[model samples]
Target: MSSQSLEQRLLRAWYGKAAWLWLLRPLSALYCRVAARRRHAYLSGERDQWQPPVPLIVVGNITVGGTGKTPMVLWLIEFLRAQGYRVGVISRGYGAKPPHFPWMVSATDDPAVCGDEPSLLVRRCGVPLVIDPDRPAAARHLLASADVDLIISDDGLQHYALGRTVELVMLDHERGLGNARCLPEGPLREPAERLESVDLVVRNGAPGDSSNGFSMQLLPQTLINLATGERIAAVRWPGPRQVTAMAGIGNPQRFFRTLESLAFTFDTRIFPDHAHYDASILESLPGDRPVLMTEKDAVKCAGLAQVNWWYLSVEAHLSETFEAALLNLLSVPHSEKIEQE
Candidate 1:
């Protein structure tokens, strides 16, 4: 089966009580067992853990699909930077194969080589950013190269090799652990119980447990014309005009919902997570109507975009209590911040 079709089937099994979901339960159990064993290996020191000289914070999710990790990561980075701590970031660069183990990603780095999310994060982040399959190696490289006081690992909660000081797991409000099962049976990398171990659980919307950790709101910012780099208000595109929305992120439904909220109507074409788009494929879409995509997808579609292509940019707004709660939760003193060169 094609990757996109298979992903759809798995998503259905995860959210719905389908008969096929039951058949996948055994494999899910095996997946959990292996995951538990690996985690135990790291916790028990059976596997060597690389600790950074500075504090390393990880922003990730227990759920399998997109739970707004990217937005949260940017929020945390901004929060940390405002507090005067020199920060850096690292990502696994999924779907990208670089020439080396530790690849330093720059603002101008090719999205096709560094992966869409990593490239987007690097562009938004002024801090040192590195991408590698081995996250520990990337972290080590960042620490050695930059005089950063803290490090943030994007989307690697299951990667226990890089010793983390704090774990901030992001959860979607509506789909919080769909069916509450792991992997093939449901949409979780770790089980629901894993939330108990995380330092903080951030809800991306109002429909989640506020008492568990804290709530975060993703505020939709203006849309950027991918073809010409012009900013436009999201609401401006919604008269009787309809556009085609394209997203290749982990959760395309979230993008569609955002558009709906803005009073925009569009036909959706959701590709698999981190899927690339070529100019020819984009050319097939209606040229008369604008094409909207996520910032992640915009990175991959940079040179491939036509005049009507645009991408929505979002900013994560943390709850008032979350900022103070995070500071208290980590027990880090702002006085200890070292200004990096």
Candidate 2:
């Protein structure tokens, strides 16, 4: 079966009342034991971890799907810069196949070569970014090449080989933890209790209650024409009521819901997370009324987009309390931070 098909089936099994998912619990248990051993190796110094001279922050999720990590990373980049710090970023570059390891990604780099999220990030903020499957190597390359005092790993919560100064975990407030199991049995990458060890837990949408973690909202900013680079306020979108919407992200439904909130009517084309696109694929859509997608998708489609193609841009907004708490945490020395951990 295709990855997309498997993903859909797992999503159904995880979030819905599918009794057969219990069969996979045995495998999940095995997976958890193995993961625990790997983590223990790092913690006990049985395996060496690369400790960077500068502080490194990891923004990631324990959930299997997207939990607004990209937006949170962008927010951190902007926030730290505003505080007069030179910031750099590193990512595992999922699905990226650059010619070499630790490749520096610029705004002009091809998304297909450096991965969609890294390309979108550099394009949006122009921050120094490096991509490699090896997270520590990427961090080292970023520091060697850029004048940065701090680094942010886009998504590497499970990469214990890379020492982190602070860790921020993101979650979809609505979905929460979906069955609260791991891997094929459910949607979590780690156990639910992993949240207790992280420096902060950020919920993507409005918190249902105080126990849900610090609230974060992905505020829509504007819509940009992929082909012409024209911008218009998202709330003031003056387009046809109906359009062809597509999202290849981890949770396409989230994108659809955002469009609905904007009063848009659309027929969606859901693709597997990180699915690549080309002109012929988009050309097959029934009509050309208008095509809208997330800015992350737009990065890959920009070169092949038609005149009517546009993508919505969003900015992450967090509460003042969260900000103050993050700043206070950053003020602590790395050694002391490790001791606390």
TM-score of 2: 0.96
- Candidate 1 lDDT for residue 205: 76
Q: Candidates' lDDT values, in order?
A: 0.81, 0.87
lDDT tens digits by residue: candidate 2, 1-341? 12355676677678774788889999989877887788889989999998889888999998887789999999999999999889999999999989999899988888989999999999989999999989999998998999999999999989999998888999888888999998778888888888888988999997532665898898888999988999999999888979888888887788889999999998888878888898767767655588889989999998888888899999999988888988998899988877766
What CA RMSD would candidate 2 show?
A: 1.8
Error in Å for residue 154 of model 2: 0.7
What's model 2's lDDT at 194?
84
Candidate 1: count of backbone clashes, pairs at least 3 residues apart or interchain: 0
**Which candidate has the top score in lDDT?**
2
**Which ten residues in a row are the worst by lDDT in model 1?**
332-341
Q: What tens digits encode model 1's per-residue C-alpha lDDT throughout 131-229?
A: 887888898888888889888999888999988778898887877778888887888888788888877888887643468667777778988988789
Which ranges of candidate 2 are over 4 A from the true structure? 1-4
lDDT of 1 at 210: 63
